[model samples]
Every structure is written in C-alpha cells, then in structure tokens.
Target: MGDDGPAARPNILVIMFDQLTPGALGCYGNRVTHAPTIDRLAREGVVFDAAYSNSPLCTPARYCMMTGRLPSATRGYDNAAYLPSTIPTMAHYARAGGYRTVLDGKMHFVGPDQLHGFEERRTTDIYPADFGWTPDWLRPDERIDWWFHNMDSVTRAGVAEVTNQLLFDDEVGHQGVRALHDLARDDDPRPWLLVVSFTHPHDPYVTRGRYWDLYEGADIPLPEISAADVPLDPHTARLRRVSAMDEVRINPDDVRNARRAYYGNISYLDEWTARLTATLGALGVADDTVVMLLADHGDMLGERGLWYKMNFFEGSARVPLIVHAPKRFSPKRVAAPVSLVDVLPTVTDLVGAAAPAPVDPLAGRSLIDLCAGDPTVEREVVGEYMGEGAIAPIVMIRRGDLKYVHSPVDPDQLYDLAVDPHERVNLAADSAWSAQVKAFREQVDRDWDMDALHTDVLADQARRRLVDSALRTGRVTPWEYTPPADGSGQYMRNHLDLNEVERTARFPR
Candidate 1:
C-alpha cells in the first residue's frame, strides 16, 4: 500500500473452494465441465499436477493447511475437532509480518476460539463450530442420521435456485468484493491478505437453472470404476455402510443428475473467480497481487461408488492448486506430488512472512522452490484419516509413482500411478512388488504408531461427546461467530468530515 515501488510487499489473495477435485476442471483434463476463468489462471500460472488434501475430510484438511501440521499432531482428527489457540496459523504469521489478515468465508473452525489469529473475519461460518458432529468410534455400527451424509444428496439432485450452500457462498462472494474495495480505501500502511473461501460443489448436489442448463443434453461421463467392478476392501466396505449407500437403490439417472449439478456449481464458482480477479484489476492492484487457488478437499462425486470425501482415493484426495503470479514466476506445470499442509509454508515464503516454530513441528515443506521450477524438489505427500467410517487410523504415503494405503485392520493397498491410474489392481498382495510394499510398510511403522493413534482418537471422541451432551442440557451458548456492526462510523457519519469520507470512498478519483 505504501510507495515502495517494485520492492513493495505483495498482497496475497487465497481463493479456496470445498469438495472440489482436480478432475472437475478443464485445465485438469475434464473436457465436459466448463470453468474458463480458472482455466485462464492455470494457463497463466504455476499448476501443481498432483496436489492432494492431507486429510480428505473438510475440517481436518483445512486445519492441516492453516497450521502446516497433520491431524495427528494438531489433534484435529474430525469435523468437531478443536484447534487450540496456541497453534500459530498463516494468518498469525502474516499479521506478525505487518499484513492485515482477513477471512471472508468458511474455514470450518471448531471450538470457542473461532478466529484463530485473523484480524477480521467477514462472515460467520456455515457449519456448526461445536462438537455436535463428533464421530463415535465406541459405537461404530450406529449411524447418526442427522449429521451423516447419505444418498439424499445424490438421489434428490436437481436444479435449485436456492440452497443453504448457495446462500452462504453468495454472501461470501459479496463480502469478498466489498473487502477488496474497503482495503483499497483504507489508510492502513500494511499489505493485506484476504482469504475468500467458498463451500460449493460439495454436497446436496443442486444448482441454479442457468448453470444446470449449460450441460443439458450434453453427454456427461459416468464413473470410470464402479463398486461392482472390483472387490471392496475393508475400508471401502465400511464407507458404504457408513453413508447408507447399501440402503439406496441408485440408478443411472441419479448419478447423472448429481454429476450435472456438481458441474454446474463448478461453473458458479468460476464466475466468482472472474468477479474477484476483475475487481483486483479494477483497483489497479492486480500487478502487485499474488493470487493462489486451492481447495480443502475433493468430492468423490460417485467415483468408485463413493460420494463426498473421507478416503485416500484420487477422486476424494486430489485437489486443484494453481498460483497465478506472472510477475513473480513463470507459467509451468509441476508433476511433483504435494499436499494441503504445504500451503502454510508456501504462503509465508511467498510474502516473506514468518511462522514461528510450532510446538508440533510442521509436517510440510515449502512448495516455493517447486513453483520456481526446481526439478529436485521433494515429490512426497503424506495423508491421514481418523474420522468417521473407520474403527482405526488409516494413513497414506504417495511418493514417486506409487501410492501406499495402510491401516491395521484392513489389507494394504498399493497402486502404481505410472501404470494403473485408476487403482483397479491392488499390487500390495502381488509378490512382484513385495519389496516396495515392504519398504512402505516399514516407513509407516517408523512414522506412526497406529495403535496409539487409534486409542487417542477414541479417547478424544469420548471427551467431546461427554462435553457436548452436558452443554446441551442447559441454556446453550453457541460458539458460532457473530460479526460486529459499525453503523455509527460508516458512510456519511457526522463524527467525521463528510467531504473527506466521500473523497476517500470514491475509487479512481
């Protein structure tokens, strides 16, 4: 904001979406769906080909990006998991380095401390910030119908001009546009970091008629792999029971409608992308802004007969990561594997900010080198899931061309992406790749104590359940954020000079 010329610290804009997979975008090789704005960013930016959500669930994956730590380290194992106030986030780091940090939409933060270091949170979160959604590992067979996702999102998918998600995202976009205008007018000397996160194309697949008609009569592709095509592993079988997929009779139409609605929402988000970036250009700050786009996690969208996220499958785990800063770096595609945890370090590196050494050491390495076209950067990504549909902790390590999934209760799964991209065959049991699988097994053993992690998750779940039950018995005080109103000082208030206010508010004056 100051007159530091080319040496001025760049403003950072992070645009994030929920339950969006790389396969849904045109730049990621989806020919059916239309997302021209995002495609333009990818065409003129650094695109990471194999970026994944460290944890496939919403809250855990978000926490991983916010703290640069894993669920095991942060104890943020589920949707209701709490992130302690002590953990320093990218917001805290940016604010410390003389930046105004603001959050416009959903971060899925749980517990009493909602704004974990954000200077200004523009909107209240869409999801509950309490422990009501905690998963009960003690009763693994019991399903909480109120909170658990079911086939209703698929079977009842269609055109809707209004939905709870649509309403929330609309406000998020409006607030983002207003925030940019306010930032342009503010007298604060510090550069700003704005996070405009949208919860879209996530679930309850529905969209407006205009977006829905974009794919009308267009042949939509079905899932390449079906549940019947391969034998179900223990985890996949558990997921089926958890989502109540076995109860519903899904026909071809149900899958088609759901995919259509999901694609429509993708276009909706693309529109917002165009709006926000265009606002930056109108404010004459586009050249000094670093725009990065990513997602909390990916949706299965009925891929492999799975919907929503909570697994290590490519559809659920892989996310779109693109950094559009032609002024800072060249446009190129990096094939190296990365994950959500790397976001914190990468952002800090980009803005020349500092994230103090965390209590639990950060599990991510900075991707700035990879964005700069360094071929020797690490290509490893680690993932963990200890949330619902699991009786034990499951972990995944993707390195080079192979992905290894391990859980104490289920059989190991090994897939070589170089050969079998769809993961149809499980090479874990094959004697030919025994040595590589053995190496992966040993690495898992050294990296994690699965038994201990399982016990810890169970114990935390019990504590949260007990606390939630006790709190619901009396007058409940909700933890949801409520933004403050500043009506007295806004617009043409008599407290300030009216002419000065008008002069500052008018852009391009």
Candidate 2:
C-alpha cells in the first residue's frame, strides 16, 4: 500500500445525465437499449442498484445532490425555484479545497451569478432564461424568440427536420466533451473537479443518425396500464392525472415506438459519455480520476400510466448511480437504497474537503464505507412529490422488499417489490399486507418529520401554479421572474415584496 494514499486523492469527474432511468440502459439489462458505453462503465465501476432521487423534479433533485441537503431544506422543491446562494455546495467546497472546478452544460440555474461555486462555466445553456419555454425573463437578444415565432412555420413546413440539429444537442454532450478536452490541457497546479452535465435523454428526444439506428428493430416494453390498477386513494388519482403517462393512452405499437425513441436518446448520451472517458484517457488522467455517474432523476417512459416524472413511483424516483473511484475502492454492487443527496458528502469526503460552517444537517450518508464492501448495512430511501395544481401530494418510502406510497387524494399504494418488480399489484388495501403498509407509512411519516418536509410560502405558491397550469393548460411553464437591469440589488432586497405580488397576482395565492 502506498503511504501517500494516491488512490484517496484522485481528480473528480462527475457526469450527470438529465432524466435518465437505470431501466433504459443495457447494463441494467434493458433488452432494447444499445447503451454499450454505460454498460462498460458499470463493468468497471461500482453500480448502485437502488439509487433514487430525493425529489423527482429537476431543480429540487439537483439542489439536493449539490448541497447534501434535502430539497425541502433548500426550499427549492420545484423546477421554477432558484437555488439559494447560501447553501454550501459541492463545487464550492471542492474549489475551497484548492481544486480547480469547472462546470459545462446545463445547471438549470435561474438567477444571476449562475456560476454558483464553479471556477468557470464553459458553455452557455440551450434552455432559455425561463427554462426554454418563454422569452419573457430573457434579455432582448438572449431570448429564444425564434422557437416561439417560428413554431407555426416549423410545424407547417417541417423546417430544420435534420436529426440531432436541436439546441440541446449543441449544448450538452458535445459541449461537455469539448470542455473535458480543454480542461485536460490546463496547466493549473491544483487537482480539478469537472462537472459535465448532459441534457440528453430529455424531451424533444432527438439524436444523431448513428444513435438512432443503433436501436433499430429492438423491441421495447410498454408499461402496465389498466383501469383496475387505479389506487384506492384519491391523492394517487390526482397524481395520475398530472403524470404525463396519463395522456399516452394510445395502442401498444405507439408505446413501443416511444420507448424506442427514448432508448435512442439514452444510447446517444452513452456515446458522448464514452467520448468523454476516452478524452480523459487520452490525457493520461484515467488512472488518477474518480468518475461518478448519476442522473438528477429518473423518467417514466410509460410505467403504470406515468410519463416523464414528478411522481413518487419507482420509475420516476429511482436513478442509476455509479462511482468509479481510483483503484482504492473495489468494484461491487451496492443494493442498499441511496439518495442523490449523498453525492455532495461523498465527493467532499473523497477529496478531503471541509464542509461549510453552519452546514445544515445532511439527509444523505457517505457511501465510502459501503463502497469498501461493508456488509450488514442497509438504508431506506424516501421520495416525495407535491402535485403542482389540483394534484394531491404523494409520498413514498422504500426500505427493502416493500414500498409504500401515500396519497392525499387517492388510495394509498403498497407493492411487494421483491415479488412484483413490475409493480403490477397494489397491496395497500389488501388485509394480508396491512402490517407492511402500516409500517412503511409510519416510516415515511417519521422521515418526513425528521427532514422537516412541509408546506411553506414558496411551496404553496409552487403547488398552486403547478396545479393551475396542469389543470388549465395541461403543462407547467417555466417561471418568468426577472431581476432589475440597474444592478441596484433592490430586487434581491425586495424579493419578499415582489414574491407577494407574484403569488397573489400571477399564481393567485
């Protein structure tokens, strides 16, 4: 063993994919996916089998992962909210510890000073200031006015129909690869922490011709959807309405087509990840790098009549997490349930960095010991989804073999995950599984109280707008709050006053 602990202090390369589920990868044994690179990573690294997102939505999940705090702790439990500046983020800690931190691709940051703790942001985001939907919050020149203005033209004329020509393509994988190549050439004396955030496998599911053809003729499975599958709880019923999969009531063929397209996107991301890894190797940094692969959250391709995310279902909450530590940690599968919040502490622990003073209690535990192959240790992962509009709140707890989901609007849901991995049967109302359901529900309630997950001014506003938009327009629009141009800092000072007006007028608090 080396006394210097060379393995303990390796360069960190964190690669995150947007909205990718473990089930969509070949390493997870998905028959339809052609994700060879990700599969190779799994073979070389420690693959986490039951890793989950603290929250199913994007911003909240990313906030939890970056801060080592629960989404509720940051009060950024929705996509529209901005990450608070005060949180002790992973990048900040790494930079403070003398690591050169670089961020490329999407961070989904909403306000000025979007760089957060990263030393540099290499690429401009493809998403508009208002999360790619509206131009109201963007600068006059920076707004995506063309997308909206030419929407009719594109729809009518099929203009720009070439494969992989979309904005996300330019910003995510390719930009991330370029950033890696650039970072490799940097002569900075300090070790580096590089974040390559890819926007792939997200919506508008477009990929290059090579990736698209990789999954040709692959049979994709459709989710189980039946009227009898309805939960006895009304809260779950409300959640089902907000779940995008509800709109996909088409035939089996259409479902398969959609699944194939989603797999194509995943494969596209895999190719880019392979390229990034190759770049690292070419720079002679592969052996000294600790590469961590994870998704901010998972997506429900069509599981149980759920599409997209923002639910407590397994397909939505469970994500793939793989950590390839430099030689010190042996490759092994971690079956224990883990959350994205664990990411911050794990990275901090690995890099020998100090966390911020007055750091809030972390909801996640470091996986270092677990990665060392410690047995007899287990963890229960919890997830929550506060319905945007009229949708009821959904809470889930997964301990081991059983998973319980509580809904305020619909019937409570219980599944014997060990027996029915597909989650085809609900045992909540079954008297035989009453004890299991009760125990899981109690565990969930205790966890919620422990984490202080509760409704607040911001959460309330989020819920109202989310529900209103879902009910009225059938989609959630990005938040459009703009700061003043004069840089007077008055907007930040008077945020409460502005938010009051916004809550009351814009979202009808």
Candidate 3:
C-alpha cells in the first residue's frame, strides 16, 4: 500500500448491472442464487447493505452516477431524457489527470456524443441501437451488433432459454472478458478507468443450457406482499400500468412464472459476474484496481404485484453496492444508506483526482471516508422517482429505521422498516404518528417541491414528439424543440424516416 498521506492512485474498474437487487445475490443472504463472484468480491472489500440508486431507472441512475448529482438536480429525471453535455464527468476528470479511460457495454447515453467523458467507446450500446429515436448507423464490430447478428441467432433457435426468452448471460460475460483483455494489452502507460456494463437479469430472462439447467428444479420464492396492499402514490400506480398488474383480475401463474424467470436470470448473471472477476485477476490488475460492482436500479419482480421497476418501493430503489479497493483500504460491511450520486466523488477520491464544483449541491457524500471507517457521517439517504406520464410525482426519504414517501396525488406512506421491512402495513392514517407524518411532509417540502421539480418534463416531451413526428411524417422540419447534439437530431431525421419508408413499403396502406 502506498503511504497513507494521499498520493496513492489506483486503477478503477466499475462493473454495473441492470435491474439487479441486493436480495437476489447469494452474498446478500440470497440462498436461491449462487453469486460466487460477487460473494468473493464482498469478502475482499466493503459491502454496503443500504446502497440505493438515485432514480429507479437505467438512464437517470447512470446520469446521476456520471455527474455526482441527483437526476432531478440535472433535470435528467427520466429514461427518455438526455444528459446535457455541459456537465463534467468523472471520466473527464480522470483523463485530465493523465489517465486513459475506456467504456464498454451500455452507458445508456442519449444524444450525439455518446462517448460522454470517456476517451474511447469500445462497443455500440443496446439502448441507442434498439430505440428508433437514434440513427441506424453502427460501428462495424460493435458488441451490440454482434449480439443482434450472432448471439440473437442462438436465442432465436431456443437453444438458450430462461424466463422471458432473453439471451444467455454468458454471452454478455464473454463480451466483457474480451473487452478487458483488449484493455490490458493497450499501449497506454497511464492508469486506466474501464467500465464494463452487463445487461443481464434485466428482462427477457433467457440463459444458456447449463445455467438454465442449474435452476431447473429450484422453487423460486415469491416477494413478500399482502392482499390488502394498494398503491399510496400515483407514481406507484404508473408502475402498475407498466407491469400490467393494475387490472382487478390477474393470472397468478403468469406472475409466478415471471418471478421464477427473474430469479433464474439473476443466477445466470451471478455466474457471468464470476467469470468477469476471474478475467480481471488473470489480467494481473486485480490487486491494483478498485473494483466497484453496482446496479443501475432493481426490478420489482412481483413485489406488490408489480413486475417491472420505477416505483418508490424499497424493492425498486435499493440496489447492491460492493467496492473492492486494493488491500490498502480496510474490508468491512457498511450499513449506512448510500446513493449512486456518491460514485463519481468516491472514484475521484480513490484516484486522487480533483472533483469539479457541485452542479446542484450534491445530495450525496463521498463513500471514501466511509470506506476509511468515518463515524461522523450520517446514515440517512434520500431518493426520488418522477412518473413519465400523467401521474403526480413521488419523493422518498429514508432515515435510520423510518421511511417516508410523499406523493402529490395520494396519501403519504410511512413505514418503520425495522418493524415492517416488507412494507406490508401503512401507518399514515393512525392518529398516533400524525405529527411524525406532518414533519416528514415539511421535510419533503424543504428539500424539494413536486410542482417545480419537473423543470425538463416539457422539454423531454417536446423532443420525443419531434422525433415521433419525424418518424411519422418522414420529413425533417425545424421545430420549437431542439435535439440533443449527441447526434440524436441527425439520427432521428435520417434513420427514423428510412424506417417509416421501410414500414410503408413492407405493408402498403
């Protein structure tokens, strides 16, 4: 270990998974799934039990992690919104400090400059390619293209099937391994920051033959829920719509199968994580690299009869955060609540790089001090989720054993996590804690205003409408809406029109 006085610099590898919850991991007391790789990493490093995503969605959470600010702070609050290029990213800071940065897998960035702060983007992401909003142009040998053209063929053949007919997790794992191998051989002498993102356990829960067979006979446990449960917020109602569970009558078998598939996907992802860790060790940089394993968000998987994410529930908000710093940092478990916004500052601290001034006075604190076992830091964390449609906004604050959820269009939700960890009971109407509920409401108002929080909602709607109109009209005309420079405008103007033409030609109307 370098001298403890602050000159130490360590290479950083951030491995992020999509829609992975902490309770699904073997290391987090999940007996159903065997996540040996993640378990080993936890044993070697610090495991944060209460780590959370700032927003319970992919693009927003990633934007927050990249900027060290909450999604609401940057006005990038939804999946459809783009991250403004004006913000400085940790990658840019590392590059300024003479480090070589490369990003592989999915960044989920919308716009023309998909590279964001990274010096090199090694793979074409699944987000831009799959979504018709972006251009059809793809790199010759992009990993996403490889999946679409090759791995998907295996999926179509049904040789590898899991929950929702998704691709095998090993396929993504192999891709990450290949990327790491290339990074290890790069001629750059400067320390490197490599980001490997995996789209496993997210959806279409399909896995390879062996992985599927591993969980074939295992009975997947259902999420804890009560028959009397009802959404206390409009945001939760919106989530119910997406999950297709708002109907009064539903098929129980379908729900059970979906949950089983989700768990199977999680187990498959665990195996791939194991492979990723082994590949890192084989590359000889394991000891010198600070490996952080986390998720963009989590899946509901039938929690309260929900299938997807984007609610303020603990099942969707809480995520897995494992940080394996080289032997210099003490290894232990941290029970404090930590937000994804802390990622950027934490990485900067580890590499001894200068963090830029706060854009919105960050709601997160660096985990570096926590890693060193600081006792003065607060254990409370706050999170927010804004509905994309007509539903009212929701804000959640978790402090110690209490959780407060405020919704503009519905009754407030208060849960004593220590007493009701599953959130089966709601104590808002009880006369005893009316004072506590009022205080929580006041705190929410002081921290944020639901009406004023949605600064970019209209702008986002305008951009989406512009793109959709272009796709429909097949003509690029100037509009009141301006597209993000990351080439989204040009892509929308060119590719979406072509798609419309193809569709019209394929099926004349």
**Model 2 lDDT per residue over 144-250, tens place:** 33442211211122113344425655555676676666565545567788888877676544455566676666666767654456433454344454332243344
Best by lDDT: 1
Deviation from native of the Cα of residue 106 in model 3, angstroms: 1.4
Q: Where in model 2 is the C-alpha error above 4 Å?
A: 1-7, 128-166, 224-236, 243-249, 353-358, 387-392, 444-509
Which has the better lDDT: candidate 1, or candidate 2? 1
| Residue-by-residue lDDT tens digits, candidate 3, 1-509 | 24453225777888888988888887788787766778888888899988888878777788888888876777666665666678778787677777778776777786556777887765556564112332111121222232121212112222243433243234446667776766666555677788878777776544456655666767667666743475445555544444334434535545445555556666666676777778767876667778889998887766776655676677788899989874757878898889888898787776573444445566667798888888777866777765342244567788887888877766888888888988877777778989988888899889886776544555555565567556557553321112223656332456468766444333112
**lDDT agreement with native, every candidate:** 0.91, 0.67, 0.67
TM-score of each: 0.98, 0.79, 0.81
Worst 10 residues of 3 by lDDT: 134-143
The parts of candidate 1 lying over 4 Å away from their true place are: 1-8, 353-360
- How far off is residue 391 in model 2, in Å? 4.1
User: Comparing 1 and 3 by lDDT, which wins?
Assistant: 1
